[model samples]
Target: MAKLIMVVEDNDLNRKLFCDVLKAQGFEVKPIADGNEVLSAAREISPDLIIMDIQLPGISGVDLIEAAKKETSLKDIPVLAVTAFAAKGDEEKIREAGAAGYLSKPVSIIPFMNAVKELLPG
Candidate 1:
């Protein structure tokens, strides 16, 4: 089966671009705009990987990742925190929040896909 990647992003354009790229590469994409619903959705989907936008409405992506890490059912799925914020210490904060790695936006297709492959290599 194709790998399932759950994407939590608020921006419509950015979400579309991210999901489109993944779909084009033959991966199933679950694009979510609300960070609040991420945990519940993640539990249902049990995705192979999760990519999230750090800046979001309602609950922040980092907090949601922390919550995901706490949940036994979702804890093992690799989460990649994707943020446009390139400020100092952003990557460290992302990792500290329980993400396996980080991806900065606007993400290039090759590197983005490569990150996913590294996390869920076939």
Candidate 2:
């Protein structure tokens, strides 16, 4: 079965781009626009991977990642955090929050897919 990836991004364009690319790569994708809905959706779907955007409404991706890591059922799922604000030490902060990987905004297809493949179990 194709791996299921949940994409949690607030930007419509970014979300669409991520979902389109993942779908084209033969992966199943669940696209979400609201930060508030991520946890519930994650728990319900138990996706193989989560593509998280650091800036989101209601809750930040860092907080969500930390929260997910604390959940026994969701801890093992890897999160690939995507952020437009690529400030210094941001990657480290996201990683410290329990993201398995990090990608800056305007992500290239090769690296984006590479990160996804690296995180997902084959």
Candidate 3:
């Protein structure tokens, strides 16, 4: 079966781009704009992987990752943090929050796909 991917991003354009790219790559994608609903949505979808944006309107992505890690059902799924903040220490911060990997925003399709592929089984 095709892997399911959950994209939690607030930006309309970025969300659309991410969904389009993942769909083109033949993965089932669920795109969500609200950070508040991340945990519930993830639980319901049981996604194979998650791509989360750090800066969000309600709960921050970092907090969501930390929460997901504590949930037994969701903890095992890999989460990739995608953020616009590419500052020196941001990667470390995201990792500390329980993200499996980090990707800077305005992400290139090649690297983005590579990151996703790394989390998914071949």
Question: Highest TM-score: which candidate?
Answer: 2
Q: Stretches of candidate 3 above 4 Å error?
A: none
Candidates by TM-score, descending order: 2, 3, 1
Q: What is the C-alpha lDDT of each candidate?
A: 0.90, 0.96, 0.93
Q: What RMSD, rounded to one decimal, does every model reach?
A: 1.0, 0.6, 0.9
Backbone clash pairs for candidate 3 read none
Best by lDDT: 2
Please write out the lDDT profile of model 3 over residues 19-107, one tens digit for every residue: 99999999999999999999999999999999999999968899999999999999998999999988999899899989998999789
lDDT score, candidate 1: 0.90
How many residue pairs clash per model?
0, 0, 0
Model 1 stretches astray by more than 4 angstroms: none
Cα error, residue 13 of model 1, in Å, equals: 0.6
Deviation (Å) of 103 in candidate 1: 1.4
Error of 2 at 100 (Å): 0.6
